[model samples]
Structures are given as C-alpha cells and as structure tokens.
Target: MAGKGFGRWTVHGDGRGLAPGAVVAPDERLSWPATIGIGAQHVVAMFGATFLVPLLTGFPPATTLFFSAIGTVLFLIITAGRVPSYLGSSFALIAPITAATASDGMSSALGGVVAVGALLAIVGLVVHFAGARWIDIVMPPIVTGAIVALIGLNLAPTAWTNVQAAPFTALVTIAAIVLITVLFRGILGRLSILLGVLVGYATAWIRDEVDTSKIGEAAWFGLPEFTTPTFEPALLGLFLPVVLVLVAENVGHVKSVSAMTGQNLDDVTGRALFADGLSTVLAGAGGGSGTTTYAENIGVMAATRVYSTAAYLVAAVVAFALSMSPKFGEVIATIPTGVLGGAATVLYGMIGTLGVRIWVQNRVDFSDPVNLNTAAIAIVIGIANYTWVIGETRFEGIALGSAAAIIIYHVMRQIARARGTSQEAASPASAPAGTELNRGEPQH
Candidate 1:
C-alpha cells in the first residue's frame, strides 16, 4: 500500500504463530514481503479460469489479464481497500460473447459487452440506494449454501479426471497440501497451500511434465493486443440479458465473502457490485470480455483465511506484470494438470462446503418443509448443471440453483401466507437478513 490515492497498508510484524487458515481481516496487514507472496498466490488462483475466457471467446488473453489487474486496483480505490476481492474475466458471459462474435465483427460485438457492464453498474446503484435487503430476500442461508455446495459438486468430474490422469503427482500434491495445513503453524501454516503447490510443481518437473517450450518461444516484452469497441445498438440489446447472470454470480460471491470474513458487508456490497460492472466496461472498451468477481480467488481466501486487501493489490501488480510477458505466462502454463487438479480438488471442495457451513451456522430451520425441500432439490439441480434458458437469457449452474432455491422458499412462504392459518411449514428462520452465523471464528 502506497501513495495518497490508495489507503495506507500497515505492515504487521506479528504475522506469525497462527494456524493454517488463520483469520486476517480486510483491515489487517502482513509484512510487505509476505504480502507479495500472498498476492502472487491470488493471481495463480485466478489464472486458470480468467485466461480460459479469452481462449473460448477469442478476446485477447493478455488484455483480460491487464484489465483484471487494473480493474483490481480500481476496485481497491473505489472500496477503499475494505473488500478483498479479485476482478477477472467472467465465465458467465462466455456464451454471450461467443454468440456475439459469430458474425465475425468483434469490435461491434464488444459494444454489446459494454452495455452489459452498464447494466451491472445499474444493479449496484440499485443495491446502494435500496440497501442490501434485496440480497437477503434473494439469497438466504439455505439458498446460498445450496448454490455454494453445487459449485464444488459440478466441478467434481473435472477434478476427478485431472487427478486420475496423473495419479501419482496428484496424490503427491494433495499430500503436501494436507500435511502442511495440518502440521505447520504461524506463517508456515498460513502459506501451506502455496508451499504445497511449489512442492507439487517440483514433483511435476521430476516427472518431466513441466514443458518449457512455450516459454522459450515467447518474447520478453510486449503489450497485449488491444482493440477499441464499436458501439452498436442492436447488439447492445442482445447482450443486456447477461446482466442477470452477472447479478447471480456476483451476489453469491459477495455473500460468500461476507460469510467467510464474518463481516456484515451489506454496505460495501454496492461498492463491490459497481466496481465489477465498471471493470467490465473498462475491459470491454479495450476489447476484453466483461469482468466479474472470481470465485477462484474466494476459494483461495477461504483456504488461506487471509483476506487482506494488500494481498489483492499484490495480485493485481503481479497480474499486470505477467500480462506484459508472454514468457512468464508460458512458465505459468508449465504448471501441470496434476498440480492444479489436486489443488483445485481441495479448494473447490472447500468452497462448496461453505454453503453447508452457512446452513449450520445460521441454524436454518431444516424441519420446515419449505426450507428442507428448497435446499434438497436445489442442490441436486445445481450439481447436475441445470439451466433455465429463456430467449437470449440463460441461467445455469450455481445461478440456476440460487434462483430456484430463492423462488421456492418464497413461494412456499406465500402459499403459507395465503392459507393464513398454517403450521404446514415450520417457523421461518430466526436470523435477521445478512446474518453472520458464527462470530470470531476463522472459516476453514
């Protein structure tokens, strides 16, 4: 943390002697050296999914990296570094961008992308003015947990395939991570995941799975190929529906962060929402796909329990630096499936389990037929990767689960209300909106 523009980052000398996943609040800080290490980890956490967007949508990968870095800094500025989040290319918009580019005019197609950003910004503004009550109504604990759990379940097959493909290395990687988390303490404990990854990467090299060919073929210095958008009204209408998808993804991300951090961040939620939207607009103006808060980083934060904004700043800086170096990306690309696969298996599983944590922490009324049925069915549906496609708008995966859970809960509430004298459903949840279930405990 430096300069007057961004708030000050106080480097704490007492960053040691804590357990793995030790809680570090947004306002707290680690030493500058440690912060850099944490930052690099965050970038690595987001790399797989962020870069995948460009490969699929034909947007420049480097541009996505560059904007993600810049957007992260911008997000920090807007939120005063109170929120620990990473802005990255959103998979939610992948289908829309692909469809838009089918006619071969990417610049024109990006015009629609810009509108999508604007819509997200508008949603943020609404949240800002309306208060986060809507978030509570839309995503109570049961619904949030189902959606979160579904994310891990949906990724189950991918994790299985990657691990199976390279069982020995994958097992080594997982063993390293597990041992560190269980055995280490203090700074060593906090950094277990990154250390485990390094160990795994070393194993990959020993197996000759690390490929340096791409790194050798790349240039040392260059700019990401950037493009300027061409505003086209027709396509703008076409891409607007993506705003709905974004809302679902972002709201869930913010809620998860709130749950993880044990901070009632409903006030800051609007700022975060707006920052993501603005990031999309800025990325699109330069020919990158729209951006959103990445769940990958959330998983990292969850596993590490270090949610300092300083770490995010470090991630942004490293990402920007990497964006300019194809060789650096190639080096990163050398990370084998075995390493990432094992790491993701644990990380994604942890992220998904947060939903159940929320459920138990909040003491959600499972006896209530509405709550029980909504969660039960919604989790199954989401894990199956179910989707609701209406016209150009499509909601799938976690979003579909979230939408269904919320609707079902409320609809059951309504039916009970209509009947006027019913104990058919048990009592509603006693917790208030945006409740933080367990106070002062670090989430694993």
Candidate 2:
C-alpha cells in the first residue's frame, strides 16, 4: 500500500512508498555532523600512538600531547588543508631515543631528535625544488624496499623483548589482536588493535600487574612541563647516524602520501617538511621526544576511505585536550608494559606485511638476474651486517641496515648496466639479408 509522508519520498523497486520515519542519509559533500563524527574516529584511531611516544621516551606525556596538536595543525595549514598528513610520535626514532636516553638521559636525547627534524626540513626544501625525480635517483625501490623491510625486522626483536617481560600476558594479547583482525570485518577489524590493548590490559590488571599509584598521585590538570635543550657532543654523535636514516625514511613517507592522495606533492613538500621540523623542535623544547608521520594512521585513512582535513584537525584537538590533564596522561601511561608489548607485536608484523605489499604492487620480477642480484644483496647486507662502525662510533639496528641497502643497490645497478651494454656489443649485427647473423635466420 502507498504511504503518505511528511517529507519528500520516492517509490522503491518493490513499489513500496518511502515513509517519513525512514532515516535520511547525509550528503557526502557537505555535512557538518557527519564530518565531525568521521573526524573523531580518526582521533580515536591515533590516540594510542600519540601518547605512547612520551611514555617510552621519559618525556611528559602532556608535553607530547601539546606538540602533537600544534604540529598537526601546522601540517594541515602548510599543506593548504589538502592532503591529510597526520603528524604524531614517530616509531622510526624509537631505537635512537632509547639509546640516547640510556646514555645521556631524556633531555639530551630529545635535543638530538630536534636537530634531526631540522635536518629533515632542509632536505624537504631541496626536494621541493628538485621535484620527486631526485627521490627516485637517490633512493630507488631496492633501497626503499630493503629499508622498509629492515625497519620491521629490527623492531621485531624489541617486540619480543617486551613479550619476555610477561610471557603469558603478551601471548594472550597477541592472540586477541590476530583473532580480532582476522575474524572481524569493517569497523570491528579497524578497532582490533584498541580492543587487543584493552583486553590485555584488563588481564594484566586482574593479575595485579598494573600499578595505579601514579595515576592517583597525578594532578587533575597541569600545564605541560617544558625542558631546555642541553647540548652534548656524545649524544649528538650517537644520534647523527640515525638522523641520516630517518631522512631517507621521511622521503619514503612523502612518496607514499603522494601515491595515496594522487596529488603532485612537490609544491607542498617543503612546507610540510618545515612544519614537521618545527614540530620536532617544539617537542624537544616542551620536554617531548621526536615526531614523525604516523604510517598506521595512513592505513586507517586507506581503510575508512575518509579523506578530509577536518578529521586530522579533530584528532589534533583531542590530543591537545589530553595534554592539559596530567591525570589523563598518567592513566594512559599506566597501561602495563606487557600489554603494549603484545599489541606492538601485531602492529610491527603488519608493518612488515606492508613492505611485502609494496614490493608486490611494484611487480618486482625476482626471476630476472638484475632484480634477483639487487634484492639478494640488499636483503643479506641489510640483515647480516646490520650494524656499522664509523670511526669509534658504532651505529646499530635499522639505521645501519638502511645505509647498507642503499649503498649496495646503487653499486649493483651500476654493475648491471655495464654488463648489459657489454652483452649488446658482443652480439653479432644483422646481415644484408635482413636477419640477425647470430640467430641463423633466413633472408626475407
């Protein structure tokens, strides 16, 4: 039967009239309520990463929170609000920060990270004028692929190290994440990481592993405590190697973002880089650690198909709000280390899978001699001699692997090109009969 409605309606395939009670879908182009909801979702997705940096680096989570908001806003403004480049605590500098804090303390370590960010901004300017052509020339697929693979490989040990702290709890956490990711689809799958962390934390708490004393002691609201930058030659030297590696990693990120947005990013690359650099500088001054473009958030954007500047703006706002309350930061920090470890295992493993995906998407031909040799040498050199010593200073982990892979690939490419030229020269020329002499083909 035809139904009368208060709002405009149309008949459907079954010839049933639409009713006024039916929910109306919002328009995609301009819907304020829907946009805010989507933006909040982006905030929720990156909350873990935004706070984790400070917890690990011995910086005030409040300060990390403050700068994360400031940095993200700057990133959005500099990009002219076009590309959704979410800025947060970078996992790339985790090892460096760990080593620095162990040797010289958190303040000095943060200073080194600030310096590295400035260096990245400088490189970004160079890339802006030169365009992406230089990126390909300097860091080819072989180099990038190896570096990405090594990033996951190097982090794998750290994940295990975290697991060893509480074997049973860590195992449970990892299992939960994997199961959720595999069994669920859409929003459920997207929330798997958060759910795993929550479940693992609950288990640890029930086991009397969590210590909430810090949370209770923390003030309800406090200004972010800032620290002055202290110069230390040893800390700077220790961090320099990693700084170089991070620059290369940053280039890969720029490339990935460009590919994702299908935008010619060269125009905005310099500005974005400058904003990132400035953010790092501010983070260090504010008693926070390094900042980098969060790749996990990139995956979030890809999965949700939500591409809007306002989403990141909302995330930034949330980060800022969290920064003002010490109690809130303390609560987040109270998550048992074992729980974080379990979740990290799944996160790091997915990063490795992404590297494989990149190689596959590029359609890399492993059967070809040049390709085989390039890949073989890169993987072996990256994994085997994963540490390097420059003068008396020893650079270890992913930094060494990245440098080695880049160097090896360039040399291999040169050798391959020369071999190809020589082979062409050695081949016999075509005869007057219109067939190549070497093939023994008949005259046409």
Candidate 3:
C-alpha cells in the first residue's frame, strides 16, 4: 500500500521537456528534479483556497495544512495511486462550521465535522459495495449542476462584504488575476490565483491594510494545535448538507480525471469518497478543517499536463513541511480582507461557472422543463440566501438549495415521465451547445 503511493511511478520521457499534446500519467513521473518542481507548483496551486477556508472559518491554518497534506497522501493510497488528486480544506463546510461555532462553540463545530465525515464514509462504503449508479440516479446532471452552482452563488454576499472593506485593494486583486491568466501561459497562467493574491497582498500592505504583528509574534516552528470534538446532536442538521456537496465534488473529480486521462476511474470513485471522508474525520480530530479534492490542483495538472501521483505526494510533503512553521501560517493569516475579497469574487464566480460546465459537458437538455425548473428554482433559493430555522437547527441557502434541487428534479422528472411529457417544447431557457450559456468545462 505504501509502495502504491511512493514507489510505482515510471519516468515519463527523458524527465526534461514534455512534448506538445503529451501528458504525464498518474502512475508515471518525470525526473526527480522536474517532478519536485511540479510538486511545488501543486503546492502553490492549492495554497490560496486551502488557506482561505480556515482563515474564513477561524480554524488554525497550520492544522488545516497538516491534515490536507496527510489527506492527499491517504487519497493516493486508498485509490492505489490510480487517481491524481490533492485533498485540501473544503469550502462547503465553512457555513456549517461558522453556525455551529456560534451556537455551541468550536468544539461543537468539530463534532459536526466528525459526524459529516462519518456519514460520508458510510456513503462511500455503500457505494463501494453497490457501485455509484445510485449517485447518478439521485443527482442527474441537472440537479448536480444546480447544486454546484448555487453553493458558489450563495457565497457571493460574503465576497462582497469583504470587498466593501477594501474596495480599491479588491479591484487591484481581481484585475491582477484577470490580467495574469491572459498574459502568461503554462504553469504561471495556472498559478494566477496565488500570484494575484501576492499582488493584492503587496497592494494591501502599501495601503496599510494588513496587520503583521501576529506574524512577528508567532514561533518559527511548532506542531499545529489539536482539538477534541464534542458531538451535539442538535447541531448535526447544520452539517448534513455538506455531505451532499462533498459527494458531488468527489464524484465530479473522478469523472473529470477519467475524461482527461481517458482512463475508467469509476472503480476508484468510492475509494476516493471514503478517503476524503476519512481525511475529514482525522482533520476534525486534529482541529483542522474538513477536506475536499481541490480543483486548483486539477487546473495545475491540466496546465502542466502532469498527473503523476508522485508529484502529489511530494506536494503533500511540502505542505507538511510548511505547516510545521507557525510563522509561515501566521504570514498567511495576515492577508488583508480586501485581498481575500478580491480573490473570492473571482474564485466564487468561477465555481458557479463550473456548474454550467458540468451541464455543457453532459449535454443536459434544459429544454426539458424538469431540468429547467430544477435549476431555476434552486439557483434562486441559493442566490437569494433563503433561510429556514427549526427550533435550534438552521438550514440556510446552500442546504435548502441543495435539497430543493434534488427534490425538484426527482419529483418533476417522475411526474413528467409518468404523464408522457418528458419531451417538452423548446424554450428560451434552453440554449444550444457552444453558445455563451454552454461552452467551458470544469477541469475538476
């Protein structure tokens, strides 16, 4: 099992230059030096969003990095190194964590994380035994796309709030990201988010927006802090929704890799889910944030055309090394609200766009009223930030929107089919393929 993660990669080419249209496979690597360089690039790719989750949610950034590194390794091992992915802090869990922390304390939030992880793990075990067909049945392309889209859109207000804090800095950061993507190609283009963050950070400092006292006070090296999870049954509702998002993320990851590598990674889908759930469980126990397969690293793989698990293992090592430094974590923590706002504005929209990509890639027929209505209703509920509270438990936009999508899709589809009206007339809501509505596809 250890060998699966570390020793099985065959060298790709002369370990120097990648030929045009060439890709390095998960089980293959370039030379050690080249591989290490790519691994470092992976670290940079995951850095922005990985740290952002913890910073936004009040978790220890170092702890999140530590578990993220460990989680990536575990994912590789569980999938037998067949799938190329990097597990990082999941944004889906942020809302639940915040609510739980507010209601009961951080310990209760950790407990919620554990419960969600356990639930996801159980789902994985079921998928492993029964196969993943049920996932598709429950969440067709329409529902999946809507759920994905709404989660991103729901977070837009948060981005705006941060942007309002430092509007000028936010604009600089957003502009930097936009310019960087077009100005450069290869790894640099893929690293636009990290680069833009640096640009924004510099701009913030110049504008006296960042507070660096914490960085100076932090120690050079130490272990990340750990916390004990205290499960509160009442808070469980706040986190149950995240399980659905995580499942969507994991399945989409497997499918994306399958599409890119031309390999049938379906067999490892359950393992991927289980690995992520187990990683989250470990993270909650250690005071880190819940983990997910990161799309940022997927972008790096696409840009560099290197999918070697070896590089991911190396990336994990680098993250682990960095997490050992309290000072490094503090430096990340000191990034100003404006810089975060700028980055989030771009990043969150891209996430919403990803849902549309899923639809386009799958050729979802939105003309079917079932599909159109599902998305229309769910997206509104999510973007409008709908809220419903029951006693001490609360379900907000993401949770409600997800539920609405799933329920609406299934109910509407079943009725349409039963009534022999599945093929509805074309409507403006359905756009042709290759149009502005349906063009790009998600790298993840």
Candidate 4:
C-alpha cells in the first residue's frame, strides 16, 4: 500500500517499476532515466512556439530560455509540482509587445508585462479565496468544453500557414506522425511526434530547405540577452486586458489536463493562476517575453500519455541548458517550417478532439438549449478570429468566446430559471422520443 510521498499527492506503486496500464500521472513518475528523456521530448514539443515569439518580437532568446527555466521551477514549487505545464513565451502578448516596443522601447513594454503578472496574481488570490464552487458555477461542463475546444480551433490557421510553406514535406510529416501514433505501441507511440518531426527534418534536408549555414557560425555558449523592465505607467493601459485572455487560456489548459488524466485539478486552480502570474512577472522583469502555459506541451501530454511533473521539470532544465548554446537554438531553427506545421496540424486537432471528448465523457446534455447555444456560439467565435479594440485593450476571438460562453450560458440559465424552466428539462426538438443520446455521462 502507498501513502502520500510528496506534499499532497499519493505516490502510486513502487517508484521502481511501472506496471502495465499504470498511468504515469502528474504526481506519479517513471524512473529517473526515463523521466529525463521524456522531459527532453517535452522541450522538443514546446520548442517551436517558445522560441518563435522571441524571434518575432525582437526579444532576446536568452531571456526567454533563462526566465522560462526559472519560471518552470517557480511554478513547480507554487503548485506543489502537481500541474504538468511548461512555461514559455506567450504569443498572446505579441501585439502589445510590438506596439509598446515601437513607442516606449522594449524595457518599458516589459515593465507593463511585469505589471500584468501582479494583476494576474491578484486575480489568482481572488480565485483562491472564492473556491471552485462559484468558478464552476460560471464555467460548467459545457462552457469549459467550448472554451477548451476554441483554443484548439483558434490555432488552425497557424498550422495551415506553416504547412503551406512546404506542402509535400508537411504532408510527409503528418503521415509519419499518424502512422507512428496508430501503428506503434509503447514508447514508440509515445514518441511519434518526435519521430515525425525528425523524419520531416530529413525530408526537408533532402530538399535543401533547411539552412545549414548557421550551425557552424553560432557560438557554442553565450549568455541569453536580458532586458530590465523600466517602470512605465503608460504600458499598463496596453497589457492589462490581456490578463483576461491569459486567464481564459489557463483555465482551458488546466481543464484539458483534467480531462486527459481523469484528475480534478480544481483545488490547484488558484495556485496555478498564481504560478503562471508569478512566472510572467519574473520573466518580464528579467527581460524575457511574458511566459504562459504552453498548449504545445499539453498536446504532447495528450499524445504521449505522460503527465509527470518531474518530466516537465526535465524539459525545463533541458531548455535552460540549451539556452546557453546559440548553436543548439540555431539547430532548432533549421527544423523546417513544414515539419513544425505538420506536427501542429495533428497536435492542435487532437486538442480540439480532447475538448469534444470532455463533452462526451462528462455527458453534457446537448438537448439543453443552454448547452447548444454555448457550443454553437463558442465555436463560431473561436474560428472567426475577430478582434475588438477599446482604449488600448484588445479582446481577441478566444477571449471573446471564452467570455461569451460563460456569460451567455449563465445569463440564459438565469433567465430560464426566472421563467420557471427546470435545469433538467431538454428542448423538445433536440431530444425527440425521450432519447438523450447526445447527453454525456456525469463526471466523477
């Protein structure tokens, strides 16, 4: 029999041998050798997006790496190492970073981002004190499912954009991932994405698509560039609203992990928020792009079925180590756009499917107009990619959809209750003949 080994978690099984069908959950772990290797894969999974933000925003790559490492460590300590998330540069801040960098310089924009972390921490404090009851009241099964699904769908364009760059290579990569994921069992299946990317890189090399020139020229080791966040009151106007977007992203990310691992992380929501906020704040202060939980790593978890927080730490360690090597970063840059694109296609789609699976597993009642309307509206808003700007704040599609799903669902639920409609009642048109096949099972 096993008891709690670390903090609040009950360590299942002897830590020596992993039994068949014994899931390696966030709290549980494999052997150290296996863990470090898996952690490296997680780094591979998060690499494309983590590095892309700095590359695009003119932020120093070293800061991204260094802060990301420290951020992960901080998050692990804050969440009691229960959440298996990788903190990386958030693309959500790209717009604000770009605008601020143009006018007030990079340091000022970064100062504003540090302020964002403080705001998020306050929000986290509120969530922590309020408890899950009210939060769940607002973000019930249907609403959470829609929000999670929106995240996956929202990235569909990015996947397509990369694939368009090298169609054949991307196609080859996709096929490799699908074949490996479907055909192989055990660790091979777990590493399918890594193998797919590798195969795609080879294909790219054959086609002369990968640039080989940078590998030799890059330094073996160098300090990552860092910027000090200069206190700028004005920058707050630009990035404050992005907090809502970050919250939406984080909520969906946590829910997705819960759905995948059959673990209820509701209790850790406050800590998670606090961890991400502190990470962003730390990253900003250190002159790195604001860090957030990465979907790419989440997708890797879904695909690999490994949720070891230790493994995530390994990834963080690997990323931090590699940050010192410009050559390593350069090598990563050569991994053909097509390869990353193809992986994105499968990974992103899998996230969307996971959302659908959540709805199915929870047995969300589609016959209920509340459920139907939320799902319908959320999907459209997610795919539409619309943005609204007001007084320097911008609400993108996912942010708007996340808000809409919560607001519209609860608002309608209130109206229905006022009109004396029972919460259990289904629409006559959607559930004919007293059948409720569309309804999901009650969650444990």
CA lDDT, every prediction?
Answer: 0.76, 0.61, 0.79, 0.79
Deviation (Å) of 18 in candidate 3: 5.6
Off by over 4 Å in 4: 1-22, 425-444
Candidate 1 per-residue C-alpha lDDT over 13-130 given as tens digits, one digit per residue, 9 for 90 to 100 = 4764444445777777787777777787787778877887898898889888999999999888887777788998887777667767886478876777788888889889998889
Error of 4 at 126 (Å): 2.5
Q: What is the lDDT of candidate 3?
A: 0.79
Q: Which regions of candidate 2 fall more than 4 Å away from where they truly are?
A: 1-58, 81-86, 90-111, 182-185, 230-238, 257-271, 295-311, 373-385, 421-444
Q: Residue 82: error of model 2 in Å?
A: 5.1
Question: How far off is residue 100 in model 4, in Å?
Answer: 1.2
The C-alpha TM-scores of every prediction are: 0.90, 0.74, 0.81, 0.91
Query: Candidate 3: which stretches are off by over 4 Å?
Result: 1-58, 91-108, 232-238, 256-263, 295-311, 424-444
RMSD of each: 3.8, 11.0, 5.4, 4.7
10 residues in a row with least lDDT, candidate 4: 427-436
TM-score of model number 1:
0.90
Please give me the total number of clashing residue pairs in predicted model 3. 0
User: How do the residues 1-444 of candidate 4 rate in per-residue lDDT, one tens digit apiece?
Assistant: 121322344344654454444567777776677667668778877888888898888898777888888888888778777678998888778888888898989998899889888898888888888875566766777887888888888888989999999999999999999898878666667778888998999999999999979899999999888778897777788888788778877777777877776666777778888888999998888889888888878888887788888888788888888888898878887889999899999888887877786677666788888788989998789888778888666778888888888888878888988997746643221101101232443233
Q: What is the lDDT of residue 143 in candidate 2?
A: 58
Model 3 lDDT per residue over 120-205, tens place: 99989998889876776776667767876776688789789989999999999999988987787654564566688789999999
After TM-score superposition, the amount by which residue 279's alpha carbon in candidate 1 deviates from its true location, in angstroms, is: 0.2
Q: For residues 299-366, could you state the per-residue lDDT of candidate 2 as single tens digits?
A: 55544444456657767876787788878766777777787678767665655555554454444555
- The prediction achieving the highest TM-score against the true structure is 4
Winner on TM-score (3 vs 4): 4
